[model samples]
Target: MGDNNLLSIPPTFLDEVPGLADALADEPLNRVAASFPAASLPWALLAQQARTHGNYVNAYAYARTGYHRGLDALRRHGWKGQGPIPWSHEPNRGFLLSLFELGKAAELIGEADEVDRVHTFLTDSDPSVIDAILADEAAHAPGTETIVIRGIN
Candidate 1:
């Protein structure tokens, strides 16, 4: 498994969702599904996990949640989306990473509108954002492993 951990997610949020514990105890796919109910780091993790397991439906759900939450986080930080996300915002990394995930998820789920929206945002934002997220993923893992965000429309 990849070691791309996100920032700490609030325990309260996870606790509020029913069946979280049960889902965690179930098979891997269930755990990923459990993550879909939360609008936080878990969504991003779930998106990646589901995609890895070839569960495109769940991946799309989780990725969309992650993308929306990321956008909300940016909005909270006063991001107008006119340029690259500001470096000072706490969720900058998460938001940028979510865009990559969302783009791929949209493509997998055949959501052309979402793909176009994400692509427009990426085109407007700094190209280096994706590289930074990938670098962080590599840094957290052993050896030269990389996380590839492919076919971002």
Candidate 2:
């Protein structure tokens, strides 16, 4: 999001570049890119949903695509995806995080219709927010907590 010409990412989230780069380096990810537009639409939708709006459908569609991609990776290269599940999960969380971080880049660019469309979709479809993402916002507490039940020293 930028001056209608240059798209830039926040410094804090620059780590995503490496994840994206990793996808490009891997053959499975390469295959997806080589397919071009035919294979890119659903993903593009995912980006719009997640990166452009806080809406759910776009986000879920985004996440579902990654889930499918992860499925693809498993099928082609035997990559379990647990290694880079975040890249696989970006689209899902993108919807909310993108919205939270970017704050209407479309509207900032005067894309009223785009803004309206995204908001409408969010309101109408009610995209499901995954728990991992919620946990993520909370500093990954869901998976990071220490459950001290019965400790008999």
Candidate 3:
């Protein structure tokens, strides 16, 4: 029910969580996650952190939570289960990041079907998102002080 055409479903843009940026900058990740459990970004960050530390199961759990939260947001914004959840949109990044992290975690944990499904979902959402995310991570490798959300520095 969005900007759907014959060939494609419309892109979905999630609404921003109020005060999230300030909270992310000022508080710890755990605290932020606890405070805004419905927001995907904090959970995505938690998943990334867990994955970085080699906690695959924890990463999977966190990413799954973020992904579900993102789905709820998408539905609320009129996404009909299939549509472009573009990486170019700042608010969509959390969900895309969660999906990506979930794929990685699924791979590490030997969830072959989950990995394939995630890959397909991501490709369907935005074909360039994977490469874009990889490039962003490469540009902002570990040890950086700033937390990046796609273009957000």
Candidate 4:
């Protein structure tokens, strides 16, 4: 008889979405989302955009869609519900980004339980991802001016 080990789940690496990069580079985020509804990256970007515009409800909706789509992709790629979704993988960033956006939107919308759940999920997947995502976002922020302080003359 074979032993069933529930503690040894393998890591999941999702396949690349066809033309996703091209569409993201060339099209508006809305159009990109419409073109690639199955891919999590566009939806994640949409959620981030909505959040930036203070549309918390829209952000939540988009992030939710991305989260579910990511879950589907994870299942399709042999993820048995629990594994390290590493942040170092480029293709995995969409799902991780979606989770981050979901948690942020959930917090803004007062979905405290959802926020907590997402936090737990992200940490469980890979504790380093949250900081990685935040750092990436900070690096890409628009009009990010540097401030220098000196003693008053």
Candidate 5:
């Protein structure tokens, strides 16, 4: 849904609507849902875990909601690091692939604004998001930070 359409849907209705995607995400998302804990973790966090372990199924599952659908999240996921992805598992690749999907989806949907958003978010020559990713990546684990990147609207 577009942002306005999303808002148009009543909160109760949105919540009550069953997410068929959740069925696909249930296992791994459940595993890393709580950021090394055992319960109540958000889907975005689990998406991060999916990228970490290269569990593409679960990562794509989780992306249907939350910041995973945001341009900033795409930028973080796909940005090519100055060095290799901090962990052996390469989520950056998935993130990069996901960005391509977003780009194509924007084109198919005629959302040029969204295309710009994803473009500026991911592939810009400027180095801010990349720097932040470098500063924040963890070794042998997925990054769990929800950054507030500025100036990429």
Candidate 6:
């Protein structure tokens, strides 16, 4: 999000454009190559949308990219565990939530092992922070009925 040109397209911008979110879900891979840090959250949201629509292939592609980039962003931020993820730090929050999106995509794609692995990482991360994270999410969650993109403001 720092310098990525894609950030110019705010996440809410898609919400204003009807069918745009669904369109992204329909063809996530077409833009995968050009997506980076700024686009990671959008990809994650698209992955969630794809998952909801039963588009396993697109879900997997977007989820995989989101998970990888999100994980990298978290690690860079000195987060050593998973738990509920600090979903309040701008793009980091989107990346953290992407873990859940990734897990959902993995399940839809029949990647049971990947889903389990993600679950294990989350469960083993830090239970102490879970409640706070969840409360924060609920309090600041997005209004969209689809994938939950908490703390977008």
Q: For each candidate in the order shown, give its overall lDDT on alpha carbons.
A: 0.59, 0.38, 0.89, 0.87, 0.40, 0.56
Model 4: clashing residue pairs? none
By TM-score, the candidates rank as 4, 3, 1, 6, 5, 2
Residue pairs with backbone overlap in model 2: 50-94, 50-95, 56-127
Candidate 4 to truth, TM = 0.88
Clashing pairs in 6: none
Question: Model 6 scores what on Cα lDDT?
Answer: 0.56
lDDT of 3 by residue, 49-80 (tens): 99999999999999999999999989899988
**Model 2 lDDT per residue over 1-153, tens place:** 212221231111111222444554554533544443223223433444464455644444444454354344333433332222132244333333333222244565455676765444333212333344345547833453476577789
For residues 47-124, what per-residue lDDT tens digits would candidate 5 score against the true structure? 555656766555545543433433343344453322222212233333333443444445444678866765554443
Choose the strongest candidate by TM-score: 4
lDDT of 5 at 27: 53
Least accurate stretch of 10 residues (summed lDDT) in model 6? 7-16
TM-score, per-candidate, Cα-based: 0.57, 0.27, 0.87, 0.88, 0.30, 0.52
Off by over 4 Å in 6: 1-39, 79-84, 88-90, 125-153
Off by over 4 Å in 4: 1-7, 143-153
- RMSD for all candidates, in order, please: 11.3, 16.8, 7.7, 5.2, 16.6, 13.2
Compute the lDDT of residue 50 as modeled in candidate 5: 63
| Global Cα lDDT for candidate 2 | 0.38
Candidate 6 local lDDT, residue 1: 19
Error at 31, model 3, angstroms: 0.6
lDDT of 4 by residue, 1-153 (tens): 022232376677888888999999999999998888889989899999999999999999999999999999999998877778888888888898999999999999999998888888888787799999989988888653565557989
